[model samples]
Target: MLKKLNYTNGLLNQMKHSIILLGATGFTGKLIAEKLDKDSVTFTICGRSLEKLQYLTEKCTHNHECLVLDVMKEEKIKSVLFQYEIVINCVGPFNLWGNFIRNFCVQHGKIYIDISGEQSFIEQSFMMDKLAKEKGATIIHSVSFESCMADIIASEMLDSALKYSDISSYYFFRNSKPSPGTKLTMQLSKHFPTFFIHNGKMENASPLAFHKYISFDFLPGFTKALFMPYPEILFFNKKYKVNHSASYLMLNHSDAMFLLASRKQPIESVDKILKKHQSRKHNLNENDIAKQEFTLVVQAIAEDGIKITKYVHGRNMYGITAFLVSYLVKQINSGLLLKKGIVTPSETGAWSGLWNVLIKEKLITHVQELQSDEK
Candidate 1:
């Protein structure tokens, strides 16, 4: 349903940065802008708040242009996007505000990236594959802490020639706080169906559809894990051609808010609640980030009954997200993105051994692999 647009001018050579970042006033957006500025990558930051954007620019070393543009204005967005070769979107509740921007980028053959973890948004993004390939545009979603680690670990586990029958990823977070954008996305996601790969096909289910108790080597005992739909569920299944794939999140009753909103709650009611909730909270501070700990466990079951489990330990989810997005943007600019259509973080092969890079930067503390035979 999307058509490609032809541009006569070579905008890539004309723009100083060739990159435009939307939602630069948001939490993750600010971090990404700071990281890019620190790395000396000149870019233009656009958002609704000119004052905040100017304040951000004042603190940065580079003179990145700041533009006050509302995302809801399609014509203005299209005009601005025409001048950039790449667009990094940090807008939240992506299922709501993500469509026009993504469609515009794909139609215009621009490299589009977003840190969206909303499963519905991710599924919708996947639908753009055909159109993206036709337009010669590369669209990648969820390149942040949400599912990049899972994709990376799964790609590593598939290094052998063996065919995997099943793939599972688990996430555990400690001493961390969700950013306002993340919180809103979580609240909005409850309205969408959860998904997983079954028999090499995608299926929808309820949030926390399947629950079980599982233990990791790093944990003291078995903990409750809920089957939470994630971006990697689709990525691992499609990228690795696996028959079955699922992902889980470790949570307790107190963490029920992280799982799903009440089914009886109306959309208006939820929005009102979220507006109030987000106002009282701010981004994670350094002390909170210092205490943050996370573990990503990935397991793959081969057709021959052999299972390989890998673990990645890291700190500060948002920090990792900022660094990863910055790294991916750099890779894109350096011509490392080889695919022409919609892609997962690991599909481009640029992320191969990225775990090592994280480890080198002290973002990740440990990486281990263990193999066993299913009885």
Candidate 2:
């Protein structure tokens, strides 16, 4: 169940000097740091390596400080986190170190955000909801390119419906390659069972269940979308009261099949391979990112047989994520987010305005809505 907490107005305005970013030396972390610097936002960068942190700080156009602290050290983590009003964690495979920071934020009543895409980590976060509400802590995970985008599009489509509707299906399509961080996260998740929402509850499902081809209005040929477990299944199902929903990845059939087959390998071997991949420099270039495109298609059906089909189109997942995190920080700093507690992007009161900004900035290129004739 979702917990509600009171929003302390003027709280954020008082926290001018209380922002720190964890994992500041990572690939996505560096992008976020660059964005923060370009926006002239005053924030401290932190990670385990002082050398890398210093390098990032120096690269920033705006002045920023760097701190070196390992998340595995509880006392050290708490001591550093206590001084910040908000922390944007870019550390990946969040199932490992995410809980430490989340617990600190809740205990200190500090706002927390992370770019985690791990379903297990997200599901585990729900247990903190009650404590977070009591402490007046606001936490939002999976603020990255895919999960948050899926949640926002789902919320928008549900809100636009004339009647109560159940999310029938959600589809994710990206024309770009995954970042090293994303690849590592995917590798880590290979051992976990895939899940989908059915009758407002989550159930384990077979990988083969999602192997079928799906058609999209924007694209000509049918594309295969593999069944994937995204955080939205839990977040959106609870917030929107969705009866049934599932997410699919737009991948070729062979690629999807290979991913499914990979699950049978030992976790240790998979982790080793992923670690090697993560060590390589695999940043997406501007020219490639500029050519990248992502699209989400959501279909919701009301009890009376009416159907609402919505399409949200965007470009460059990584660029959009950086812009989103920066925008969210600015809003939180301005006290624009009125709700406090563990929340999703759709549940935030500032989402509608943020949506407009996304469109204006071309982070979101188009949103189309269509109504079925049955109604």
Candidate 3:
């Protein structure tokens, strides 16, 4: 459940001395750092390797600090984290490496955000709402492409619906591959629980459950979407008071078959197989990035029997994630986010704001509201 909706103006606007970018040497981390640099946000890049940190700093147009601290070293991580008021953590699979850092941040009342979509990690973070509130900490998880965009869209739809009974989000992606960090999360998350909201309660379920085919009005044919335990399910139901909330990921026949086959294998065996696949990294060229597309369809059924559907389509997930991270930083740095506690993007009262920005930036190629009779 969300804390009280007490949105504040930029209370910390004058406190933007420095922002810390943890896991700065990773793929998504580098993208975020580059975006921050381009936006003229002063930040420090941190990782275990001084060489890689220096390399990233050298590419920045603006002056930025670099710190070489191993993630496993608790003291070092704490010392560096304490020095900055804001911390952007791109470290993952967060299910393994997230608990300590988040705990420290919450205890110290620091503003912490991470590009994590792991359901378990997010759920764990949500449990700290009380501590975060008492400590005056603002903790936001899954501020990346996987959840933040969808969360914002859902919030907008829910607000329009006013009294929503059911909400569902369908994610469609084409010609895109998961980053190494995402792959690692996928491999490790098998051990975590998958759940959904039903009648205002959480129910555990199997991964890729509730298989169904959906035909979109803007798209060509029927696409297969399976239930995926995305963080949006929790946020939508909790924040919007929706009785039922569901999230689905579009998959192809081959992908479905692969997932089903892997489900039957032992966890160890599956990890090995995934690791082998992860070894072969396919670099996406310009054409590949252009071909990669993402579409999100959010439908909410109002208590009054009205149905509202909204969708947003875009390309290049990584670029969008980077942009979203930077945008969140700007919002927090400007003290636009006034809530103090565990929060999602929408709960910050900036969902529509981010939605407008996405459209204005052309990151969202299409935004539409379909008539009830349409789809």
Candidate 4:
């Protein structure tokens, strides 16, 4: 059974003096850092490579420090992390690495953010909520494209429906061309088994844990890949007073087949295969110059038989994630988030605020109203 809703309060908004990027040299880490580091907040970029750390420093016009520490060196990293006000973990294949920081953060009362969206999100997160509260830490994970966008779009569509009447059901659409960083992260994250939160309870499952096939007439039929069950569905399910909530990916059939087939393989076999594969560097265009695309669709059904759908489509998932991360930093500055606990993007209104920014920036389109008779 899922844990009871225990949303606690009383977290002081303490902006940390320095925000440390754990996976500073990676693609998403680089982008988030580039986007958020204005001349204002101080950042300390930490990773395994001193050379790469120095190389990344060149990209920052703003003042930022660099530290050579690995997350695997949990003790050292945690020591540094607690000293900072906030830490952004760009490091992943997190399940493989293990979350020692969860305890450290909870025990120490630090503000932590990460780009982790692996199937093991809550398996690694929720277990630390009480501990975090005990220590006074606020932890937000999977704040990137995977689940954050889904939650925001889902919430908005549901909210728009409430403006008319009570909501009964909803659907979310996610179409995004992931950056090279996403691909590498996928490969790294696949090192662990998949699991999810079932009825607010943590349960073991496959990585491509659950899914369905969906086709939209606007484009060719794409396979809706089963990402780990993100909190978008669960959070909105409760928030909107709906009985059912589902979201699907907008992906090519080939990619879906590849992902599913890999999921079918045993973790041991997959790791062996990865070891046997040629040593190919992780990258999309081998450089950050390449752009990607992301599409968002949120549908809500009201008791009065009305549906309102919102769309946020744009290019550059890395850039968009960066934009949202920057916004969250601002929210942190303003003290909107609650006390120490594992949080998904949907749980907070980061995505709601994100939708506004995306729309205002023309990163997303306006709302489209559909009759209940329409699909």
Q: What is the C-alpha RMSD of each candidate to the true structure, in Å?
A: 5.3, 6.8, 7.3, 8.5
Predicted candidate 1 versus true structure: per-residue lDDT over 178-221, tens digit per residue? 78887776666667777988888889976666766777657654
Provide TM-scores for the models.
0.89, 0.86, 0.87, 0.75
Q: Highest lDDT among the candidates is held by which one?
A: 1
Ranking by lDDT: 1, 3, 2, 4
- Greater TM-score among 1 and 4 belongs to 1
Off by over 4 Å in 2: 1-16, 159-175, 206-209, 252-283
Q: Please report, as a residue range, the 10-residue window in candidate 1 with the lowest summed lDDT.
A: 1-10
> Candidate 4, residues 32-68: lDDT per residue as tens digits?
7777775255666677777777777776777676666
Q: How many pairs collide in each candidate, listed in order?
A: 0, 0, 1, 6
Residue by residue across 138-194, what tens digits does model 3's lDDT show?
998888887787888776656743666778888888887777777667776667886
Q: Model 3 off-target regions past 4 Å? A: 1-17, 160-163, 252-255, 269-290, 351-356, 373-375
- lDDT (10s digit) by residue, model 2, range 255-367: 77786687676556655766787577786666677777877776677767777787778887788888878878887777775466778866665565765777888878887
* lDDT scores of the candidates, listed in order: 0.79, 0.73, 0.77, 0.59
Task: Report residue 100 deviation for candidate 4 (angstroms).
Answer: 1.1
Give the clashing residue pairs of candidate 2, or none: none
